[model samples]
Target: MIYENDISYEIRGAIYSVYNNIGPGLLESIYESALDYELKKLGLKTKRQVVLPFHYCGDQLGSFRLDLLVNDKVIVEVKSVAELLPVHHKQLISYLKLSNFRLGILVNFNVNNINEGIFRKVNGL
Candidate 1:
C-alpha cells in the first residue's frame, strides 16, 4: 500500500499541474475532471465522484460523494468558488472523519493563486 504522505505528494503535484495548465475560473467539475485525468496519467489509481455510504452508530444514514479518492488513501475535494468558506474546510474534515481517512486535500480553483486556495486537512494523520 502506498503511504499517505507519498500519495499526498503526488496529488499535490497533479493539483499544480492542472492549475498551471488550465489556470482558474472553471467550474468545479471541470477541475475535477482535469485533476482526475492528470492523476491517472501519473499512474495513480483514482475513483471520481465516489459515493461512500455513511453510517452513524450502526445505523445507515445518508451518503456522501467524494470528488476524488486517490489510491483509496487520500480524499481530494475540489471546488471552484470565489473564495473558500470555513464550511468548505469543515466539510472536508467531516468527510475524513466519517470516511475514516487520514489525509484530505481541499482545493479551490477559482483563486488567482492556487497556493492560497489549497488546504490540507488531516484526521489524526
Candidate 2:
C-alpha cells in the first residue's frame, strides 16, 4: 500500500488537472468523469460509482456507491457542494471501513482550487 504523501501527490495531480481545465459549478458526475479521465491518463485503473454493500449482524443492511475507485486501492468521492462538511469526510471514512479499503480521497469541485478541497482519508480495516 502507498503512504499518505504519495497518494496525496497522485490526488494533487488529478486535482490540478481538473481545476486547471474543468473549473467548477459542474455536476458531481461531470467532475467524476473528468477525474476518471485524468487519473486514467496517469495510468491508474479507476471504477466509477462502485456499489458497496453493507452487512449488519447477519442480514444485509444496504449499499452505497462510491463516486470512484482508483487502482482498486483508493476510494474517490466527488462532491459539488458549496463547502465540504464533516459529514462528507465521515462518509468517506465509513466507505473506506466498509469496503476494507485503506485509503480514500474526498474531493469537492465547487471551489476555485480543487487542491484546497482535496482531502485524503484512511481506515486500518
Candidate 3:
C-alpha cells in the first residue's frame, strides 16, 4: 500500500483546523461538515458519508457509511465522545478494511487539544 506522508499531513492539518473551530462535544455531523469544508478549502478531494457495500462469504452483507473519505484513499471518522476508546479506533480500522482503503483518521473532537484527538493510521498505526 502506498503511504503518502505529505498528503497525510495536509489531511491531519485540515482535520485539526475543524476541531479548533468547533471545540468539544459537538455532534459527529457537525464535525463532519466542518471538516468537509476545511478539506475542500485545502483543495483535497473528499467525500462525506459514503455508502460502501459489504459481503460475507459471497453473500451481500449490506452497506456501511463512512463519516468522511479524503482523496478517495483515506477514511476520516469523527467522534464527539469524552475519550477515544479502542472501539472507536476499531470502527475506523474496520471501515478501512471493509472499504479496501489503506488508511484512516480517527479524530475525536472531545479532547482539550486537537492534536490529542487525532489518531492517524487507523488501519496500520
Each candidate: RMSD = 1.1, 1.8, 2.4
lDDT of 2 by residue, 1-125 (tens): 65545655776798788878978898998888898899888877789989988888967889999998887888889999998999999999999888898988888989976668888887977
| Candidate ranking (TM-score, best to worst) | 1, 2, 3
Question: Of the pair 1 and 3, which is ahead by lDDT?
Answer: 1
Question: Candidate 3, which segments miss by more than 4 Å at Cα?
Answer: 1-3, 122-125
Better of 2 and 3 by TM-score: 2
In terms of TM-score, which candidate is strongest? 1
In the predicted model 1, the residue pairs found to clash are: none
Worst 10 residues of 3 by lDDT: 1-10
lDDT of 3 by residue, 1-120 (tens): 435565588888887787767688888888889888998898888899899888889888799999888888888888888877788888888888887777787888888888788887
Clashes of 2: 0
Model 2 deviation from native, Cα RMSD in Å: 1.8
Q: After superposition, how far is residue 71 of candidate 2 from its true place, in Å?
A: 0.7
lDDT of 1 at 53: 91
Model 2 pairs in collision: none
Least accurate 10 contiguous residues by lDDT in model 2: 1-10
Prediction 1 TM-score vs. true: 0.96
* lDDT value for model 3: 0.81
Error of 2 at 41 (Å): 1.0
